[model samples]
Target chain A: MAAPPHFTGSLGYPPSSPSPRSHLHCLSPCNRAIKVSMSQNQSYWTCVTQKIEDQLKQLIPVRPPLLVYEPMHHLVFTARRTMAPALCVATCELVGGQQPISPNQALVVASALHLVQAALFTHEQLPLTDRPIPSNPETLTHHHAFAAGVELLTGDGILSFVYELLGRSDDPAGGNSERLLRVIIEIARAMGSEGMVDGQYRKMLCSVLGSEELCDVGWVDHVCEKKEGRLYACGAACGAILGGGSEEEIEKLRNYGLYVGKIHGLMLYYHNNRTGGEEKGFTDLVERCTSLALKELEGFNQGMVQTLSSLVRASFWDKC
Target chain B: MAAPPHFTGSLGYPPSSPSPRSHLHCLSPCNRAIKVSMSQNQSYWTCVTQKIEDQLKQLIPVRPPLLVYEPMHHLVFTARRTMAPALCVATCELVGGQQPISPNQALVVASALHLVQAALFTHEQLPLTDRPIPSNPETLTHHHAFAAGVELLTGDGILSFVYELLGRSDDPAGGNSERLLRVIIEIARAMGSEGMVDGQYRKMLCSVLGSEELCDVGWVDHVCEKKEGRLYACGAACGAILGGGSEEEIEKLRNYGLYVGKIHGLMLYYHNNRTGGEEKGFTDLVERCTSLALKELEGFNQGMVQTLSSLVRASFWDKC
Candidate 1:
């Protein structure tokens, strides 16, 4: 549908004085301006908006409707185009260089990205396995969804860039393409159950809720190994894949991943250690984990080292 | 004083049934076992305990004194130590590491870390630059104090680590140190006036209270630059100081800072959009600024990246 021209700034007169009763006429400036613009463009409108407005007027009868029903439809329509420019740009981007995608198609892609990002983030923020479990599923779910969405957007953006590279015929089997694929897979796996999300949930539940007698250390370790640990492995695998890394390089990347995971875990533990007594141990733990992670990253091949280092350099841990 | 010997194994008692009547007396077997152990340990206690117990007893009297304070003090002292081993460890660590560290050092550190972490997380969770200026000075003071404390701890930790590097002859050149100093000063400046805090306060007074016209676009830009943009810069600066990075490397880091700052701002905007419509945007603008400041560490290094990434990974943004 064609959009109406914006008439917001075409005021008929200057603003009136602040005193009440100074300008009963001033209140209708917008309507008057709109009427004047409409009159000037009447012939053009008759050929276009006149029919549409007539149809709309007919559809929306003069009779009073259910108050609830009226607002609901109006709200939905208003919300659908609330951020018109951004959504329009997003839609165009989604449909670019490919088949035209429906609005729903774009929305689905957006939603999937959201979910993936949420899961990754939720897992990362969870405390160490030694702590208590979180009480609320909603909070967990909310975090998971948010992280997943962000990851999806980031991955999608990267993927789009990859597609562009492919389109440009830039080294069909180049290391960059492989690295991009690996990043995608790494992100996907991390979004999976055998990654950060599950590990964090398990740790939180065990520490917060599990009875001391009932809790099993092995179970907690298993969760970390399978979930959190595996995500690190996946990330390293991706790095190796992308960089065309040797076995030694791969191993170094893997070690880096493990170090990062441990640091991540320790940070969570540090956060959870709000009781004054636990601060020293947690801080020490954070230091050890960070140092270990740095050392491991340092051991990687120059390219892999550079990549990992850059990523870390772009993060907050180095600051502290 | 030495810890009392701990009893182990069976107490030579039948399994007691859950009965309210005998609950208090159910420890008879345990008491008897303790007595037996005490008799066995009499020799071990004679030399050590005689001196210690004499001192302890001397602090008390054979009969109750008029004050009745010594016994209560001793009881509390003994009980607190016995009940909380973690507390003891913290106290020892704090005292041992002391260069005139406070008596409640552990509490201070723990509380400060938690508050800062929460502030950071909350800021990230909400939309950017959307926090309203605090209506009262008290709230402002509280936020400032918390932020200052966090900055102190984080900066101190980084400086101490750098000092260690210096001790090991791994220090960067004087030029690098000078750059670090400049970065720190810049961060302080950004956090002070011409920063997010001021921008937010101005926004609050203008919007919520209707004290002025909509904030000047320049003011908004300045606020964003300081609140969101500069925080990432601070994080990057800290990272560069820690990791041996050139000026060019630090410049590259600015992209990450910018990306995170924008995202942080957007997130806060989104949150405020959902919660309070346009008016809340003013409040959220301020809040977002503060949040950015808090999250400086989160975007600065790998460990923090992992922590924040994990959190976002778990959230609802994925669904959106």
Candidate 2:
């Protein structure tokens, strides 16, 4: 239950741990390999996160109408963005992307991907259920409700802006138009009703209908696969598609992404909440998924996949 | 203002309009020409509305986890969609659209446009303001907050699905890739932070900052022009872009959409709210905007623009 001392503050996983919700703490770079190739990967992760952070800051400036842009800027910048953007940028590079000619494309798309993820994160803060409000009601102040209201508008606004970033082809006559359009569709499919939304909806259902019954071993795995796993899959696939990877390569990256996300989400959410038997099963799934992710990278040039392998190995170091 | 006996339930403009909040009643088709071109226009309106309605129903089916789709379906289907869809369909035909070879594209884009507008409409129902929630906070039920919560998630979900609809290029190899991408970008600009979101943000600010002073003549005009007007403008321009119109044609349709939306929104929300002198000024503005809309269609064939003109005249028939 203790915090991973070296990993706590690195990915915004809340410095104070020893809490049941400390699963997010274990997702940082493994300290066991911190002396060698891990540092290189760590630098890449740090460098890319800062780049995305700067680009996001530029994308959402502190303009007038502070109330609207304020929450949008806050939620996006403050999210624990260790998964999607990193996967996207790493995938883009791993596939021999057009780094010399046009590297900004990946950065832009990666940042936009972060925007969609952040919007979903904002939505997670909302209360959900069709049956009834929970029995205990807090003395809900008007300001609190108003804050929630601003967040609602801010979430919708961010999603709309995500499309704008992806679809705004600077040069319509360029050859990348088809690729960009396809990337947009891929992100949408991953984030729409069948993917993230469905996952969130099901998660809500589990909470209401009985997490004990519904979020069993398979349910948690299925939800992770559909929800966060699908998100990371689409993000990596988008990077491959944009980086001029072949269809086969994009599929490989996509499957890898799916595995990474499942491992990540499972690690983040279901540590203490699971029964010991369920935990064992979940742990087995994580090992299996991590292996599946690395298995996807085997066909690629091993020299090129260090970054990606680092991401996969990140979730389970000593266990593997 | 008793629901304009002939209008009322036609446009979902509540039949009982004796209340101060009755301006939405007046946006129905003007009755003066009901016997002539009006009937033809009415038929087209009904037919197109039905088509968009059917397309929307197919786009969002009743599936599992009714909690997610229920609010989305209810909001999209129940909105009084008399403005954007009408302008989009009418402008597409007026611009000599390729209706014979491929008619579904315009309908699809128009329907998607309605989805964005509908999502924004759902957000409007949420309480806004950085200030206190309002006086006389009644016995706040948990169900109400929970409904708002579902709607919040539904709004973001709908926006994400919209990009999927726009960017899911069925035949990516087709020559329409550029046009579709451009239309997607156009819609994003109109609905993003600077367009619909900004308009909503400002509208919220007006209510909190003092509707009396902040929402004076020019403020109202600007908000209408930016919020609803901008929404309609993008819808029509998307139609023109997808319909294969020239740059000049798309710009013209965009301007016309701006005017029509302004007239429709002003009519729907601000008749009783305006002072006598201000009402006259707004009436003059409406007339001028209507003329501007017609002027945009002047370069097109006279026969081709009858539908467009009918929509323009929809807001200010007797006044003009």
Best by DockQ: 2
Q: Which stretches of candidate 2 lie over 4 Å from their true place?
A: A1-38, A64-68, A99-102, A127-146, A209-211, A271-278, A315-320, B2-38, B64-70, B99-102, B127-146, B207-211, B271-278, B315-320
User: Tens digit of lDDT per residue, candidate 1, span A1-320?
Assistant: 11112212222122331211111121133334454334222222122222222333333233343322232223222221111111111222221212232222222222222223332332233332222344434334433222222222222222222212211321323323222323333444443333443454455445455565434434534454544355455445443433345656556556655555444434333333233554554455545544665676554334223323322222222122
TM-score of each: 0.25, 0.80
Interface DockQ of each model: 0.01, 0.34
lDDT score, residue A266, model 1?
Answer: 40
Model 2 docking tier (incorrect/acceptable/medium/high)? acceptable
Separately for all candidates shown, the number of backbone clashes (residues 3 or more apart, or on different chains) is 78, 0
User: Can you give the lDDT of residue B7 in candidate 1?
Assistant: 11
| Candidate 2 local lDDT, A87-195, one digit each (tens) | 7876777676744423467778888888888788776654432433432121121122335556666777788788888776345645677888888888888987778
Alpha carbon lDDT of each predicted model: 0.32, 0.67
